[model samples]
Target: MEDRKVIIETGWNLDNSYANLPKLFFSKQVPTPVDSPKLIILNDHLAAYLGLNVQSLQKSDGVAVLAGNQIPKGALPIAQAYAGHQFGHFTMLGDGRALLLGEQITPRGDRVDIQLKGSGRTPYSRGGDGKAALGPMLREYIISEAMYALGIPTTRSLAVVTTGESVFREAELPGAVLTRVAASHLRVGTFQYAAEWGTVEELRALADYALKRHFLDGDGTENRYLFLLQEVIKRQAALIAKWQQVGFIHGVMNTDNVTISGETIDYGPCAFMDTYDPATVFSSIDMKGRYAYGNQPYIAGWNLVRFAETLLPLIDDNKEKAAQLAESAIGEFMQLYHSNWLSGMRTKLGIFNEEAEDKILIENLLSIMHKYGADYTNTFRALTFDDFTDMALFDTESFAEWHEKWQERLGRQEESKDSYHELMKSSNPEIIPRNHRVEEALEAAEKKGDYSVMEKLLDVLSNPYAHSNEQAGYVALPEKSTCPYRTFCGT
Candidate 1:
C-alpha cells in the first residue's frame, strides 16, 4: 500500500441549523474506530470530483481517514435525530449506525455531505452495534454505483474501507465503513422527529432551511412552505417512477430512508429484479412484502402523506386549513407518478404518441410477464435489440401473443424502424447490478481478496444501455436456481 497522506481541507461553514436547535435534537460525538482498518474499495473518480488527491487516497493515510481512526481538521462528527414508520409502524429513530462527519462544497458549487456509515455506536444505537458488516457495505457500493450509472438520482459511494475485524450478526462477519456522498442527508423522518418531540419551532426552521437549499423558487412567499412540500412531492413521484421503470424494489421504504432532496438515500435490502414478477421481494427482513416491486408507487405516496402530516402545523395556523392544504399536496403525488411512469413505459415499448389503447397494451404485456415469469431486465433489453425469438424465457406462448400486440402498438408510431430501435436501446439498459453477480463479487473479495470482479462489474454497469459482446454474460438474467437471492440489512 502507498504511504502518502491525504491533505483534507474541511472549511465546513458548519451551517449547523438543526444542531443549533435544542440539545435533544442530536447527539454531539466523534466516531469510534474499528479494530484494524484496511482499504477495500476506493472511488477515485468521486475523490477527484471532490478535489481530493486520488493517488494519496490509495495509501495508509487514506485507510485511516476512512476507517474513522482519525478525524480530519475542521470535521465535526454528529449523529442526526429522526423518526420513522418502519414496515407500517411508527417509531423513533436516528442515525443509529451512521455519522454525518460534515458537509463539503464541491468545486462545482454543489453541497455534499460526507458521512461514515458503520462507524461504531452513538447514543442512538438503540442497544445495537453501530458497525456494519462487510457484505452489506460491498452491496451498497455495487448497487449505488449501478444506480448512478443508470442515471438515477442517488447517493454515491466515495470509498469502502474494511475494518480488519469481525462483527457478530447471525455469525461473525468482516466489518466495514462506507464513505457516502450526497446532496444532503435530511429526510422526511427528520421532520417527524421534530413533530414527535413537539418541537414545532424546529420543524418550521427545518422546512425553511430545506426550502432555501432545495426549493429556492418557493422562497419568500406566504405559502412558500406549502410550495416546498409540493415540490418535494413532485420530485419524489418522478424518482419512484424511475425506480419502477427499472424494476427496482427498495426493500425498505421507511420515511427515514426517503431523502428530502429526492435522491435515493439508503441501499439497505434493495434489489433489482431478475424475473418480471411485480410481487418480487428479496429483503430478508421484508417478509410481509410491504415494499414489493409493484407496491413501490403506492408506498411512496403513503410516505409522502406522512411527510405532509409532519409539515401540517407549519403549513398554516388554522388546523383545518393546514389539513386541507396538506391533503391537496399529497393528492398530486399519484397523478405525477403515474404520468411519468406511463411516459417511461411508452418509451420502453417504442410508442411515441398517446394512443388511447397504449395503457391497455402495456398492462396486458405486464400481465403476461407476471403470469409466465419473464426476466425483467432481459425482456426489455431484448426488445431493444429487435430479438423476440427467445419466447421460452417467459415459460409460455401467451408472451409471444403479447409480443405481437406490442409490435402492432409500435407499428402505429410514425418513426422508422432504425429510429425506433435506437430509441429503445437508449431507454432500456443492457446491464443492471444483478443480485447473483453482486453476491459472487462479494464472495471473491471476502475469500480471495480479489477486486477484479467489482472493477469489471462497474465498467459494464457505467454504460448500461450500450451493447458489448464482451459483457454478454452480464446482460443475461441469473439462472432460475439463483433467482431468489436474499439481501440483508448489514446491521
Candidate 2:
C-alpha cells in the first residue's frame, strides 16, 4: 500500500484525502489481485464526470488495476473502519469486500470517492472470503445508474470487471468487481465508530473533516457539529421522501448504509414496489418487515437519533446541555420529513398550489391505490398522460367519487391544465427498475453471458422522464406470483 509502488498509469487527478485521516479510521489494505481480468462495462458518461478516459480504462493494464490486480499511481487504498446498528442491533463493522482507492477531483472541482466493491478481504472481513459474484456486482451497476438517471442522489457505477474467478455462495458464482463513485464513504455508522472506539480528539477530527468536505457553505462562528446534525436531518428527510414517492424500498435501512453525504449508498436487497402497498418488504432477511416501505421514514429517524447520540459529546462539553441540543435538533426530523413528503406528493399529483385539502386528497388517492392493488408508477403515468377512467383500477365507484373530487381540486389551480400535467410528467417516471425485469436482465447476463439485455435496460433507464415506445415493454406490469418477490444481501 505504498504510494511509491506505482504500477499503473492512471491520471485520475487523485488525492488521498480519506487516507490522510488518522490511521485508526482505516487500515491499509491492498486488493487481492484477480486472475484473467476482463472489462465488462464502463460508464463513459460517468468516466467523463470523473475526468477519466474510458478508452484508456478499457486497456489491459487498466483492467488489471480495475480488477484489483494492480494499484494505480497516486492511489493509497484503505479499508475504512466503522460500526453500525444492523437491524436494530449494535455491532462493529467495516469494509469487508470494498477498498477506497482515493478521491477523484472531477472537472467540476468536485471530489468523489473511487472505490472497488467485491475487491477482496480485509481486517473487517470477519470469518468470510471477501469475494463478490458477477450477478450482484452487475445488479449494483444497473440499479445505481437507474437511480442516478431518475434524479435521485446516489452513488454512480464507473465500471464492472469480471475476475475470471468464482466465489462459493449458494452455488459457485462467477466473481466480479464494481468501481463505485460517491460523495464520500463516510456514513452515520462512521460517526458511531468514532464515538465508541476513538478518543474525543479523534471524533472531533472526523467531524472537522466531514464539515470541510460537505458543509463548506456553513459559517465558522456557529457550532459546527450542530450544523452538521441539522444538514444531515434535512438531507435524510428529503432523500426518504423521494424514495417514498417512487415506491423504492431500501429493504434494509441499517445505520451502516445511511450515508452522511446524503447520497443513497448501498443497493443490497433493494427493490421498487410495483403494488402501491406501504407494508411492502422485499429483502429476504427482513422477515418482520422492519424496513418496509412505510417504515423507512421512521427507521431513518431512528438512525438519525443514533447519529445524534454520537455527537452529544462533540455538541457540548456539558453532557446535559449536549443532550438537550441533540434532542432539539433531532426533534425537527418528523416535521421536515412530512413537509418534504407532502411537497413531493403535490408535484406528483400536479397540484401546482397547495390547499388545506391537498394532503387529504393525496392520502385518499393512495388509499384507493392500496385498496384496489393498483400499480403505483402506472397510476401516475395514467393521470399524467391518460384519463384515470381508461384504467380499470380507477373504474370503481369509489374511484369515480375520488376522481370528481380531484377534478374539483384541479379547477382551483392557478397554473393551466397543460402546465400542471407537464409538472406531473416530470415528477412521475415512465419507467422504474421493476423487479421482474431486473431479475431477467441479471439472469441473462449471469446464465447466458448476454449483456445486451442489461445494456438495453440501462439505455432506456438513462432517461426515466421521457416518453418512448421502447420503454413500454419495461413498464408492463409484472406477472403475478404465488408468493412475495424477495431480494438478498448476497454476501
Candidate 3:
C-alpha cells in the first residue's frame, strides 16, 4: 500500500509519548485508506478546546485523515499491546480495530490521546476485519458526549467519519470511524500484560511512564508503583460511584476497559438505566448479569485487585510485604467507593450536612424505586423540579411515606430551600442517552442518512444541568416493549 500523503493541516501539536516507550508495548501500523472518505460530524467545541483548526478538519484532506485514508504529520500510528480479563477469563487483547495516531498537546497544556476507532487492522486484529459500522460509531459519539455533559469522566469523541465502504456485521452496514480523545489509553490490562509477559525493567518503565503522565502529584520517587496503585484505585472508586449515581451501566466491566486514568472507556453495550432496577443488564453477551447495574462497583474493585497483582513485584522487594500492602490498598476500595457514592447521593437528595441516617434514607428511596419500577433519571429529576406528585411511582403509598420522611429530613437541614433545589438540579440530569432513543437516532442516520434527529438529540443533551422546554420529548421514556432491550458491541 502507498501513503496517500493527503497533507492534512488540522493544527496538530502531536507529542507521541506512548510511542516513545519500549517497542514491547506497541506494534507500529498504518490505517487502511478507504475509497471515498467523508466527514460525518466534527465536534467543533472539542476541536476548539484542543486548539484544532475546525475548518481544516472539515475539508476533504482532513476528512481523509480522520477516515484513516491519511495519517497526519508527526503522527506515530500504532496498535497498543495488552492483556485483559474478559469475564474473569484472561486473554491477550489490543486495539484490534483502533489506531493511536498520537497524543495532542491541547491549548490548555494538557496531553490527550487522539485515537481513531474502526481504523482498519494491525497485528492485533486476529481473525477479524478491522472495520466499524456507521450506526455503532454514531452511537459512541452520542453517548460519550452525553456522559461528558452529565459530568462523568469519559473519553470524548471528536468526530465521526464515513469510510464510504461497507462492513459485514450481521448485515452489510456502512463503514465509519470514530476519533476518540482520552486523558491517556493506559489501562489496568496494560499493567497485567507487562507483569505477565514483560521483564521487570519493562514493568517499571510502564509504571514510571504512568506516574509521569497521570500521577505526578503523588510522591512517586520512593514507592512510585504503590502510589500508582493507590491513585488508580481512588480514581476508579470515584468514577464508579459517579456511574451508580446516574444509573450508568458500563455493561462490560472488563479489566481492559478500566482506564488507569479512571475515565470511562468502551461504550459497547453500555446504556443508562431506564428503570431503577439493580439487576438491570443490557449487554447482549452478558447472559449472567455479571456487569449488572448494581455490580459495577464490585467489578471495579475486582479489576483493581487484578491491577494490584501486576504491581506486587514493584511495590516491595519482599513478596509477602508487597502482598500485605496491596491487600490493604484493595481493602480500602469499598470504603472509598461508599464515601463517594454517599456524598453524591446526599447532593442529589439535597442534603448539605452529614447525618448517620443519610445512607438509610438514600437506600430506602432506591428500595422504593426498585419496588415501584420507577425510571431512574426521571425520579431524580422529579425531585429536582419538585414535580413528583403526578408520577405513578410517587403516587404509591410507599412513596407517600418516603416523601414525608424526606420532607422532614429536608426540614432538618441548615441550608435554605433555594440552595437545596440548586444542588438537586445540578446533581440530577434531565437527559441521558436513553437506549431506545439512541437506537432511533442511529437508525435514522444509518438507514436514512438523516442526521437531523441525532443533531436535535445532541442539542438537548448538551446542557443536561439546565431546564429547557425542548427537553420534554427527549426526557420522556420509550413506550413499553414486550422484548427486553439489549445493546450490542461495535465489533
Candidate 3 residue 184 C-alpha distance from true site, Å: 0.6
Off by over 4 Å in 3: 1-9, 219-221
**Each candidate's TM vs. the true structure?**
0.94, 0.97, 0.97
Q: Model 1 — TM-score against the truth?
A: 0.94
lDDT of 3: 0.92
Tens-digit per-residue lDDT, 321-371, candidate 1: 999999988999999998999999888878778988888888987887777
User: Model 3: per-residue lDDT, tens digit, 1-491?
Assistant: 98785554589889899987888899999998888888889999999999899988998878888988888888999999999999999999988999999999988999999999998988989888988999888998999999999989999999999988899979999999999999999999999999988999999999989999999876636677888999999999999999999999999899999999989999889999998999999999999999999999999999999999999999999999999999999999999999999999999999999999999999999999898888999999998887976468978889889889999999998899999999998999888888888899999999899999999999999998877788877888888999999998879
Q: Rate the local accuracy (lDDT) of all candidates.
A: 0.84, 0.91, 0.92
Write down the lDDT that model 1 would get: 0.84
Candidate ordering by lDDT (highest first): 3, 2, 1
Superposed on all Cα atoms, model 1 deviates from the true structure by an RMSD in Å of: 2.8
lDDT of 1 at 68: 89
Ranking by TM-score: 3, 2, 1
Which pairs clash in the backbone of model 2?
none
Error of 2 at 223 (Å): 0.9
The lDDT, on a scale of 0 to 1, for candidate 2 is 0.91
